[model samples]
Target: MSSENDWNEDLCGCMNDGGTCLYGFCCTPCLFGANAEKISEKNCCLMCCLYLVLGSVYLCWVPHYFERQKLREKYNLKSNPSCGDCPTTLLCSPCALCQEARELKARESVQRSALKANNNQPVVSQPEANSGEADHVNMRV
Candidate 1:
């Protein structure tokens, strides 16, 4: 789990980022599933289907709520006021999904930058003994 925090962006900020919001809005199921997959490493197709299927009953928020809660726990995000997870997901699923997508994007960017920084860093090799081998072996593909 990550450290305690609030959502990177508010749920209502769905349109704040531009085309990602548009993509999320246009493909709500896909966004929901992809966001869920990012949080749980589960098959996005299942998530997508869940949204499409359960959506008819207007209760797609059931699974979405659970996934949102899991996302909060995974990210150590403080639940929105008044036990906001279920409400946010339930009341406006698209907005919730968009928020989750933004969060995932932010996380991915952070990870990419960190990985790139590590790759750019000079590797400090330990002094090699007479074992005919270096202490560390780094092979870049």
Candidate 2:
């Protein structure tokens, strides 16, 4: 609650001589005025160090963070790749097994389809022989 006048008076008394206060807080102009430019230089150096450290942190984190974010946006909602919907049988559909099985299945299905198509052809009919000559003679008469 001290007034400005009292503060100024204290400052003036502390600076009456060229000497500084016992605690080194007050002087003719200022206790730190002699080294003001040095203080500013040190602050600038500290700011540069802070900026360098922060830049390094940001640079190191950017690629991984962006890649992870992209992956999350791309595949986050998908089902587990390790688990499939349909049950895995001895011979799975669209199976990840060897190519031989798939090729064999394809060949078998093609052969079966070809067989079915061949069997679907129309049959040729022929006339039957008469059991007796009388029947033939009666028909002729």
In candidate 2, what are the lDDT values of residues 38-91, reduced to their tens digit?
Answer: 222224334334433544554422322232233223323222245322222121
Deviating ranges (above 4 Å) for candidate 1: 1-3, 131-141
Question: How close is every model to the real structure, measured as TM-score?
Answer: 0.83, 0.22
For candidate 1, give the lDDT.
0.84
lDDT of 2 at 77: 27
Candidate 1 per-residue lDDT, tens place, 69-140, comes to 899888888887774777788888888888888888988899999999999989999865654333333332
The CA root-mean-square deviation of candidate 1, after full C-alpha superposition on the true structure, stands at 6.5
Global lDDT of each model?
0.84, 0.32
Cα deviation at 103, candidate 2, in Å, is 2.1
Q: TM-score of predicted model 2? A: 0.22
Off by over 4 Å in 2: 1-97, 125-127, 132-141
